[model samples]
Target: CAMASLWMLLVCANAAAALLVCLYLWLIAWPRWKRETRARLKVADDATVVAFFHPFCASGGGGERVLWKMVHTLAQLHREKKRSLHVVIFAQKGPKTPEQILAGAEERFGIDVSTEGGSGGGGSMKIDFVFIETELIDLLHAETWPRFTMIGQSYGSMVVAWRGFQTATPDLYFDTTGAAFTLPLGKLCGARCAAYVHYPTISTDMLAMVYSRRPSYNHDSAIASSKLASLVKCVYYFLFAGLYGVAGAFANVVFVNSSWTRDHIEALWRLSPAPTVLYPPVNVEALA
Candidate 1:
């Protein structure tokens, strides 16, 4: 009788906690987010707003090159069309200003990004930065189980994107970092969503490694060597692949960097709308 009473008390406590969380989100978080988003990104009637999710904006890698090139291309398009386009980059706070990032991009890729509301050569398209602290992401990595790392990162990114978009949802949500988890959130916010998938989160090759009991990237030396460990990891990959497919499905449009990537994504994701292949942006002339 006492144990039954204790179980009921625990259930009641959990239910209360769930209710409180819902109340906080509905009453406190949503309204404040709406107010802040409107205040920060005051969209002009003529402007078309596009948000790019690039958490690692300062890491001037190939992906960063793609981002800068895309922005430049869009700016040129808007110029030709005589339309105002606002590009918002959701990034982590850094030592450099948006102007410095633009300068770095120009120096590296020879692409020009014009400054807005500043003393500089007049550039038509407006650029804005929405800085987010990445402590939550770091904490997720620290706290989550190793076997579920990929899924945790995917879900964590979705939460981060949700928070970032709370103030102002963009007309288009573009994920340059291959984090397809943000697609559903973007769609929820009424934005047309797209993702440039560098690679599928989990590939058939990864599954084959587990299936054949061979050591692979997904498994460490210890796990790969042990038959028992290999079997366990095979189950993990199977479940993760299903979850990844669900996340990829949320994308309204998908762009892949290469034919190899498109093949893998298509085979794995089975997305209804076939992915478009956009060759990686490389400055061959600059290199020459």
Candidate 2:
């Protein structure tokens, strides 16, 4: 009778332990993970947030121009449709404020981004800037190991994106820079992800060069000169390309800068909905 009682006690103990684990997962772990996912921004219940990942937000380059233009476009849509749309820019810490960045974009591009409720205008749409520290991203840099540079940076950007959106995730996650790693994280938070890829991380042309053992832009002096070096480099690139494709697969939609880029990305990602070609916007009047 004692042995049977002990056996029953052991069974009860196991059952209790299992129940505790389940309770922790439901009451603690899941909720904690949810809170961590939205740790960055405190979002309004009614607001439709659009988060943009642009590490070089202040840089008045082609990518920055696209970023600002997108903000302007959304602001215009918000005004026309009479909806509350908020734009959040995830960037590395810079001296400029969101207003300053918008102002700088105006000065550099000669485009009007002012909305009815914004500082520049009375537009209802607002732009918020979330700055990520370099230290967070520095851990992912592949400078020490040069061969895996693309994979390292891509993973680093993903980490940055994950943290950047943890506070207040957007309804739509748009990557102005070619960081496919951010897509999965955005999706995890129930955000639709899109990317404007300036160039494919790895192209068939690169693989072809490797396969043919031909010296191309990807093959430097050392790699091109030696057959063994070329073979090793080719294998590295092939592996990296596969990794890149997997990362890119997370994106719901992709927009390439040019037809050339579109073809390569389409071939690599093989996305069911093919990527669209969006030529970089040019200020016709400014150029004239």
lDDT of each: 0.77, 0.76
Model 2, position 38, has a per-residue lDDT of 38
| Model 2 stretches astray by more than 4 angstroms | 1-44, 115-122, 137-145
Every model's TM-score:
0.81, 0.79
RMSD of 1: 4.7
Q: Which candidate is the best by lDDT?
A: 1
Clash count list over all predictions = 1, 14
Clashes in predicted model 1: 1
Model 2 weakest lDDT span, ten residues long: 115-124
RMSD per model, one decimal: 4.7, 7.7
